[model samples]
Target chain A: MKEIVVISGKGGTGKTSVMGSFSYLGKSDLVIADCDVDAADLHMLLGPDYQRSEDYYSGELAILDQDKCINCGACLSVCQFDGIQSENGTFRIEAMNCEGCGYCQRVCPTNAIQMETQKVGEWYTSSSKVGSTMVHAKLGVGAENSGRLVAQVKNEARRHAKKEGKEIILIDGSPGIGCAVNSALSGADYVVFVTEPSVSGIHDLKRVTELVKGFSIRSGCIINKCDLNSQMLDELITFMADAGIEHIASIPYDETFTAAMLEGKTLVEYDKGPASQVLIKSWEKIKQFAETEGCLK
Target chain B: MKIAIASGKGGTGKTTLATSLSSHLSETQDVVLVDLDVEEPNSRLFIRGDQTHSQSICKQVPEWTGDCSLCGQCQEICNFNAVIKVGTQIMLFPELCHSCRACSELCPESALPLKPRKIGMLNQIQAGNLIFVESRLEIGEQQAVPLISQTKDYIDNHFDESYIIIYDSPPGTSCPVIEASKDADFVILVTEPTPFGLYDLKLAVEVMRKMKKDFGVVVNRDGLGNNDVLDYCDMETIPVLARISNDRRIAELYAAGELIFSTIPEFKEQLLLLERSLELSTVVDPV
Candidate 1:
């Protein structure tokens, strides 16, 4: 099966909007995966009713038992993260602060410290209204294992695709060049970069393009809000040319996107305005590229 | 005192606040701005500087010396897939190594040894009185937290009591963010007034609380949305240090690669007020 990941260097670049529209244009033979575990919003437009979910654990967290506690303060002194705090006469561990370094457990004189696996997030497999399986997740507040959760979400999506005999897996990747983004890009056949026409936006696009190039992956670019700055738009085109990236399509500034988002609908479902039409044309080009590149069987 | 400006959400005006505050504070104090947003750092755009020094940051990866005895213990302990055993020979992918030393530390035959590999670059630039430092992780490098840690080492080596350090951290409350904001005396979280902004600001606040650091909020583009951020501060008893209005001129200047505080003189006074308030709060609160 082919995997096409849509990613943006920075947030609020209409990545989810474009990915949502792509899901609409792509047939039922596609499986959708939302790899933005930290702040997932694609499910809002996909409207997935969760079928099953499993907790994701990454590492161990130390828990201190108050019953066997001795107020020696040795654990606090040796703790590198300052995770142990004295409250009211007992020592406690802040789950978010604990890095699970095991220094506290070792320094504990009473043997009251125990290491336990932490549930940092949950991965879900659901059925979307678009007749496709949606794989997504929610990283618990102050969670430390979003990268692992993203991997799990992608793995589950691939499993669903294999079982359902789907040909393509469209993934909505996260915003930054962090571990989660890496996980989303790894082993993907094609990558689509959704970016804006601003100074910082162009700068971040270059950075993410460099990251994509590192994996020796084929990538294309789509300029969202291409009308925001004509000069920057020209510059982006030049950059794409220099980087040997295929210029997919340029989407104009339109309020239909925001309106569709507020209504929790993709632009194709909400309105067939100029922006939506532009997205459809963009998808057509992407389809051709995927076919020519042997991404779709 | 060193303060790091950060937000869990991107496009929250972290670079604006950090550069503007440094410009205002540079009039009296020697200020240094360190851009820890290695992924997409933009502090150098606002403050122009000449390169003073540069160095490549490297991490130690394990190398198999073909000393026979291909025990499968290295594969079992490495959770990062950095080492994979292919028949009798073990293959190592250096880019995927987190430098946790689990493989080498647990090797029974001592077949694996640590070797240094460059993963990122660090540069120190001088913009008049402000010393700006930035790190760029090499492409395909999976370890950013270690680069951030090494960047902090640069700060530690060049730190002076005469200058106040300001760090512009990367977005999101992950390991890199934690490494940047680990030992700061104070943290300033920049946020907008939107619902998404408030949601991410709350997550950043939770991280700060967990780190046991004193922090406050700076609402950028305050009038763009409702006063929910103000209400949140009121409810949580956290202080709203400053509220910057939505100004098109400021945005235009930022787009033009101009410093907002230099263009808008009033923001300098607000930054001074913020500095004074932070000073007083730190003095009043016991360390």
Candidate 2:
């Protein structure tokens, strides 16, 4: 099975929106995964009928036993985060501040602190209205271990794809060059790097492309809002050419793309406008590119 | 006063609001802009200045000195999964390491030595009328929270109490956002008006409430999608600090890497209003 992850280093560059459209445009047997656990919103487009919800545990957190606590402040001294809070003469471990370093448990004098696996997030398997089984997750606000969560979401997507005999997994990836993005792009057959024509977008595109190249992944490019700056588009083309990355498609800036999202529908479903046609054409190019890598065969 | 501009999702115009307000406020008051969005810091794109200061951030990672047997005590004690021992080989993954110092302390042979590894860089960019503190993590580095924390520490170390500090944070309600927003007097969450906006904004709201930080929402791209964001803010009784209308002229300015206050003369009035509302207030229950 092959997985094509759609990611953008810059935020709001239409990674999720493109993935939403792909959910409708792609083959019927596609298992989709939303790997943006930190701010997952792909389900906003798909409106999945969640079938199962499970707690995700990664990393460990120290819980202080009030009974065993001698109020010695030993854990407080070792904590670099100041995660230990002294409240009304009793100490408590601030979960957000705790980095799960396990130093607090080790520093406890009376064994007052116990290490427990933290439920940092939740994952779900849902059937989307677009007829694809979706695997998505929500990382707890301010929670770490997002890389582990993204891995779980992808693993679940692959398992679902195997059970249903689906040959492809479409992942909606997160922004930035963080561990979560690494997790989404890890072991993927192809990566579709989406970006826009702007200074920040170009700046981030360079960094993310460098990241993808390090993984040795075959990647394609989709430039959204290419009409914003012809100069930037030209720059992007030259950069992609020099980097040996595939410049698959460039879609012009259109208000309908946002309008379609406002209506809770994909561009093609909302209106087969010029922009929608461009996206459809781009999807075709992506399929051909993936096929070239023996992904379809 | 320290005000942090944060968003639950990426590309929600945190830099737009922060830079606009910083530029406007610098007209009269002392101001410092801290770009804590280490991974993809773009605030530098909006502002121009000289490099006043620069520093490389280093973390302590346990490096084996190859002195003795690989008894695997270091690997067993590491919570970050940064150390792995295969056969006689002891490999240290610096990227995954959190530098908790437990592994090095627990090593039986005292073979593990704390080695300083460069993770990112910190800069004090001299923008017009203010100092802009920015952090840029090295590409392929996984841990941003440590780098973000050091950046915050740098701000505190040389804090000028007279200046109004504005922190422009990375998107997402993750560890990076938390590290940036941890000590802010007030957090101004910049969000767009859409389903995705509301969806992520709610997560951001949950994070702020958990931290008990003084926060209010500023609905950006007001007319782009729908009233879901505003309606949710009203329903939650959370203070709706400001609404930045989505005018094509503004979009053009932003696309061209220009600040709204500089190009659009009339928009300065609204930005000033946002600047005024940033004063610390008693927490209004958003119940």
Candidate 3:
């Protein structure tokens, strides 16, 4: 199945809104995957009825046995991270500070420390109101290894797509150039970047675009809030042209986008406004691009 | 006093408030504004300053130098599987490595030794009374927490207790945001008035409460969003720091990378009140 992932370098640029509309349009033909495991919001918009869930464990955490403790301060000395704590001659591990390197476990002569895998998060498969299967995950607050959780969600979506013989996978990626975004971009057929015309938006777009170039994946750009600043819009257009990124559609700034979100509906599902029309046009272009053979080659 | 401006949702005016508040406070206090959103550091675009100093930062990761006896102990102890032992060689994956040094230190053959790998850079800029420090992670690097920790360490080493520090933290309630605000004296949570904003703001508030941080809420684009955010804050007993109205001029200035205080009188007045309140909150008792 072909994969179309939507991401915005800067947050609040309507990435989820665009993805929600795309999911509504591609409901019958695609499976939805929300790879923003750190703060997954696609499930909120899709109203997914979760059917299956599995606990996901990625990295290990150190566990100390106080009974076998010989307060030599050996584990604390060998730890690169400040994970070990000592108070009143008792030692404990700080879960937030631990990197799970297993160095402390090795240094303990009393065999008091052992590495145990942690269930950091969970991934789920659900059927949404739009009559499509959605794969998403929830990372525990302040948990590490979000990139792994994203990978797990994407894999599950791809597996379900293969099993159901779906034609496409529409992914909603996280906002940043970090590990989560990187994992979401891997092995994607096409990427759609939703961006705005603000200075921070343009700045972050350039940074994230540089990252996408490394993957050598075909990408299209959708300019949301195109009418906010004419000068910045011109500059954005010039940059996109120079970067050889396809300009999909220019969506005007409209409150209807948020209004639709407030009502727990996609823009296309809520209203047939100008913004919705532009989004529909953008989806058509994306569909044509995804179906085109030799596009990746 | 150290303040962090953060939001769970992106583009919620963290950098906008960080840059403007730092510039205004610099008029009477020594201020250091840090851009801890290393993945996408945009504070540099808004805060123009003279280049004072810059340096490349590196993290220590294990590398094989062909000195192994095929002991395979390095691969066994690595928790992240960043190191792997092949038939006649050991392979290293820098992207997967957390720089935990478990593999290198546990190797009995001494083949796996820690080496410095470039991950990102830190640039310091001086703007009048404010010293702006921005850290940018190199492309393809996965970890942002280590660089953020190092940048905060740099600030702690260079600046004394007198300087008021402001951090423009990353968006999201994950590891990066947690690292950015873990040591702040006060946190300013920025949010919009829409459902998405309120939803993400609730997650951020939960994080702050779990961390036991003293924080207030700042409502950007107040007229654009509904009153749910204010009502939620009232019910939670969270102070409303300031409300920036939804204005085209503000958007225009932000698009042009201009400061809001210099041209917007209403915003300036709101920031002044915020500054006074922050001063009263951060005052230390005399010995």
How close is every model to the real structure, measured as TM-score?
0.84, 0.95, 0.97
Task: Flag regions of model 1 displaced more than 4 Å.
Answer: A24-29, A62-115, A129-131, A252-273, A294-297, B105-108, B225-230, B265-287
TM-score of chain A of 1: 0.93
Candidate closer to the true structure by lDDT (higher is better), 1 or 3: 3
Per-residue lDDT, model 1, residue B75, is 82
TM-score (C-alpha) between model 1 and the true structure = 0.84
Top-scoring candidate (lDDT): 3
Interface RMSD against the true structure, candidate 3: 1.2
Tens digits of per-residue lDDT for model 3, A226-292: 8888899999999888886789999988888888888889999999988888888899999988776
Q: Native contacts recovered, in order, as a fraction for each?
A: 0.21, 0.79, 0.74
Cα error, residue B130 of model 2, in Å, equals: 1.5
Per residue, candidate 2 scores C-alpha lDDT tens digits across B216-261 of 9988887888888888988999898888887767766776788888
Q: Which regions in candidate 3 have their CA more than 4 angstroms from the true location?
A: A293-297, B280-287
Q: Model 3 over residues B1-287: C-alpha lDDT tens digits? A: 89999998888888889999999888877899999999999999888779999999999998899976988888888877788889998999998898888787777777888899999999999998889999999999999998999999999999988889999999999889999999999999999998889988998998899889999999998888589999999999999989998888887888889988889998997887787677732445466
iRMSD (Å) of candidate 1?
Answer: 3.3
Q: What is the C-alpha lDDT of each candidate?
A: 0.80, 0.86, 0.89
Candidate 1 structure quality by residue, lDDT tens digits, A132-174: 9999988765666567788889999999999999988999998
Q: Weakest 10 consecutive residues, lDDT, candidate 1 chain A?
A: A288-297
